[model samples]
Target chain A: MNQDILVKAIDVTKNYGHFRALDKVGLEVARGEVSCIIGPSGSGKSTLLRCINLLERMDGGAIWVNDELIGYRRDGNNLHEISDAEISRQRRRIGMVFQRFNLFPHKTALENIIEGPVQVLGEAVNEARERAMALLERVGLADKANHYPSELSGGQQQRVAIARAMGMRPDLILFDEPTSALDPELVSEVLDVMRNLAASGMTMIVVTHELGFARNVANTVTFMEAGKVVETGLASEVLSAPRSARTAEFIKAVHS
Target chain B: MTTASLTSSMSSTAETKYEIAHLRLVPKRHVGRMVAAAAVLVLLAALVRAFSVGQIEWSYVRDFLFAPAILDGLANTLLMTVAAMCLGIVLGVIVAIMRISGNPVLSSIAIGYVWIFRGAPALLQLMLWFNLALIFPTLGIPGLFEMRTVDVMTPFVAAVLGLGISQGAYTSEVVRSGLLSVDSGQYEAARTIGMTQMLMLRRIVLPQAMRVMVPPIGNEVIGMVKLTSLASVIQYSEILHNAQIIYFANTRVLELLLVASFWYLAVVSVLSIGQHYIERYFGRGSKSIRSSI
Candidate 1:
C-alpha cells in the first residue's frame, strides 16, 4: 500500500512440476530505485524478476504494481484468473530486456522500437516513430536505425533492445541478464546504457551477474540462492561488507 | 577490403621474413567435369532430335493449342486450381493453429482430420466425393430445405472439395512446421510488449513463419496445377479431359497430348518464376540477403 513502492512481491512461489523455481520470494522496489538481483545460475533470480511482471505465473502469493494486484482478480475469498487481454494490459506498465536481446529480426531497429507503442498502445505511427528515433539516439544507435538485428553488432543489438524497452514509456523495466549473451568487449557498451538509464531515475529490476555494474549503479542489491532471498541490503554493504556468509561467499566467488 | 588488407599483410610478412616471391597461382582443371558436361550436351541433343522427328503431326498440335475446347478446358483448370488452393490455404492455416492449440479436443480433431485426408490417395478421395450421392441421397437441413445429393454434388463441386480438402491436410503440416521454426524468444518478446495472442500471431509470428512456409507452399501450388488433371476421372472438363475428347474424335492422339503437355509446362514455368519472386520477398532481412534501401 506504500505509494513509493513501484513493485512488491510477497511470498511468491513458482514450480516447474516438482522442482521449485522460486520459494517464498519477497522483495520491494521503490520508485526511481534500481535493484539488482545477483546469484549463481538456477538460484531463481530470473524467475523472481519474471514473476514480478507476470511473465511467469506465480503458484503462490501475489505481486503488486503500484497497489494493483497483477494476473488475478481477488473477490472475497476467491481468486479469478484474469483474461489474456487483461494480462497483456497489465504487462504494458512493465518492459523487459532479455539476455539475448531478442530484437525482431524481420524488422529494422527503429521498427522494433516503435512496435510496442504503435501496435499495443495505439499510439500514432508518426509519433511512435519520432520517439523511437529519439530512443535510438539516446542509446547512441541513431545511425543504425534502419539496420535489422542481424546487421548490428552484439552490443548494438542489446542497445537497440534497451531502446525498444524504453519506447513503451513503461514505469519500470525488468532486465534479465541483458549483457550475458554479449561478447566480453561488448558488455561495457550495454552496461553503459543501463548505467545511464539508472542515472536518469528510471526504476529498474535487473537480474545480472555484472558485479561492477551492481556495485556502482544499483541502489539496493539482493542476493538470492535456491529460490530464497539470502541477503538484501544497500549495494555497498552487501558487496563490500555482507551480513551473511552466503552473501560474502558469493561476492568472493564472483570477484575471484 | 578485407581480402585486399589480408593480401598486403601476407606480402609484407613474406618480404620481411622468408625472402620468397609471391607464388603464381594456377587454377586447377578437372577432366571429369569437362567429360560430364560433354556427355550431358550430347544426351540433350539426342533427346531433342528424337522428339522433333517422332511420329506426330506438328500442324495438329499447333492448331489445337488454342482451340475453343482446349481454351475452355485451360480456363477451367486455372479456376479450379485457384479455388481449391484458396480453400486449402485458409483451412490449412486454421487446422495448423488448432493442431498447436493447448486444447486436447481441438488438437486431436486436427490430427484426425490430417490422418484421414492424407492417408487416402487423391484419386480415391475424388471418387468418394463424386460418388457421395450414393450415401447421402439428399443434403441440406432436414426441415428447412433439402436437395438431392446427386444434383448438389456436380463434378466441379466434387473435384474442388476432394482436392482442396486433401491439400489442406498436407498444407497444415507445412504450416505447423513453419510456425514451430520461429524462436521461443520472439513469442516472449511479443508477450512482454503486451500484444494479444491473436495480434502476436498475425503481426509478429506469421510474417516470420512465411520465410519457412513459402517454399513448401510453392511446391504444393505447383503440384496442384498438375493434380487438377485427376478431376478428369469425374469429367470436370480440365485440359487433359478436353485433349482426350479431341483425340478420341480426330484420332490425333499424340498431337493433342503434346498440346496439353505444352500448356502444362508453360503454366508451371510461369509459376516457378512467381515462386522465386515470392521467396525473395520473404527472404528479406534474413542472413543471406542484404538490407533494403
Candidate 2:
C-alpha cells in the first residue's frame, strides 16, 4: 500500500510449458531501495525480475511499476494485453544487466551506452554521446571508450554494462547475476561500481549468488526457493539470522 | 657447517656456463605433400603452356573484347545483376523476417515461396516467366479492364522478375541462417532496453547477423553476375546473348564466348574487394585479444 513503492508484484505466476517458473511470487521494492534476491538456480528470482521489466509476460496475476500496470491494461474485470510498442515505452524506465554482458558486438563501449537513449528516447545523437562519455568516465572506462566488448576483460565489460544501465537513468535497474560470469579476481571491480551506484541512491534489484554483496549493499534481502519467496526482511536480520528454515538451510549450504 | 660455508664461498667465485639446450633436427617428409607438389607443378606448367601457345586466337579476342555491342551487352548484364540483387535482397530481408516472425501464416507463406522458387530449376522458372504471355494471354485486374500480357511483360521485365524472385529464395535462407546465428541474448538485450522489433533488427540483430550473412551473400552476388546469362533465353540482351549474335553471324563461337567469360571475370574480381571491405566493416567488434604462441 506504500505510495513510494517503485515496483510491486501481486501474486504473479509464470509457466514455461508445464514447468512453473514463478508460482504466486510477490515482492515490493521501494524507491531508491537496493533489494537483493538470493536463490539457487531455477528458483524464480530471475523470472520475477524479468516479469517486472515486462521482458517475460506473466501468465497470471499483475505487476506494477510506479503504480502503472505492466504488460496489460485493465478494462472492466478483464485485462487486455497492450501492444509491444506500449510495453517498450514502459520498459524504457527499467534498465537491466544480463549475466553475460550483452553489449552489442558491433558497437564500441561508448556506442553501446548511447544506443538506448538515442534510439528509443529519440534524444539528440551528440547529447547522447556526451552523456555516454560521462558514463564511461564514471565506470573507470574512459580510456576504453572506443574498445569493443571483446577487447575488454570480463570485469571491464561488466563495469561498462553497469554504466550502460545507468545511462538510461531508469527508475529501477535489475541486475540478473551481474558478476556470476566473471573470473574470481574480476568480480570485485564490478561489485565496486554497483556499490557506488547503491551509495548514490539508485534503485536496484539484484539477483545474485554473492551473499557478501547481499549482506553489505542491499537494504532488503529476499530468499527464493522452488518458485516461491522463502523469506524477506532487513539485510542484517534475514541474512545473519533468517527465521525461515529453508533460508537458514540455504545460508548454511552457501557458507559450507 | 664447515662444508656448507666452503660450498657457498666456491659457488660465489665459480664461473657460470651459458649452455645451449640440446636441439635435434629430424628429416621428416610427407608423401601427400610430395604428391600435391608434383600435381601443382604439372598444372602450373600446363596453364603456362596453354596461355603462351594455346590456339585461343588472342588477337581476335582483343579485337572483339571491346566491341561496342559486347560493351552494351556487358552493361546490360551488370544492370540485371545490380537490379535483381537489389530486388532479391529487399524481398530476402522481408521473407527472412516473416519466416521467423512467430506468425504461422506468414511463416508458412514464406516457406512455400522459398520451397517453390528454390526447388524448381531456375532455367525452367525463367522460361515460364518468359512464356507467361502464352499461358495467360491477358493479365490485369480480372474484370477491371485486362491488358494483354505480351504488352505488359517485356523480356527485361520478365527477366528481372524471374531472376529476382529466384535469387530472393536463396537469399532468404542465407539471411534466416545469419539471423539465427546471432545469440538470443542480443535480442533479449535489445528488447530489455525498450527497442521495438524493427529497431532491434536494424541496430542490433541485423548488424550482428551481417557478419554471418556477408560470406554467403558475397558468393551469391558473384554467382548472380554469372546467373544473369540465364536471361539470354528470354531474348534478354545480356553479354552471352550479344556474344551469341556476334558468333552466329561470324561463326567464331569460342572467341565470342571467351569475350563474355573475360567480362564476367573482371566484374567478379572487382566485387571480391567490395565483399572484403563489407566483411571487415561488420567484423569490427568481434576481435578478441590473443597472446602469441
Output the chain A TM-score of model 2: 0.97
Candidate 2: regions farther than 4 A off? A1-3, B1-26, B29-36, B39-55, B142-146, B288-293
CAPRI class of candidate 1: medium
Interface DockQ of each model: 0.65, 0.74
Q: Could you give the DockQ of candidate 1? A: 0.65
lDDT of 2 by residue, A94-188 (tens): 99999999989888999999999999999899999999999888889999999989899999999988888888889989999999999999999
Residue pairs with backbone atoms closer than 3 Å in model 2 (clashes): none
For candidate 1, lDDT tens digit of each residue in B23-129? 68789999999999999999999999998899888999989999999999999999999988988898899999999999899999999999999999998999999
lDDT of 2 by residue, B1-293 (tens): 69999998777666343333555766888989999999999999999998778667777789999999999999999999999998899999999999999999999999999999999877888888888988899988888889988887788888888889999999999999999999998998898888998999999999999999999999999999999999999899999999999999988888899999999999999999999888887788877312211
- Could you give the CAPRI-style class of model 2? medium
Which residue pairs in candidate 1 have backbone atoms (N, alpha carbon, C) closer than 3 angstroms, thus clashing? none
* Model 1: per-residue Cα lDDT at residue B11: 93
| lDDT at position B257, candidate 2 | 91
Which ten contiguous residues of candidate 1 chain A have the minimum total lDDT? A1-10
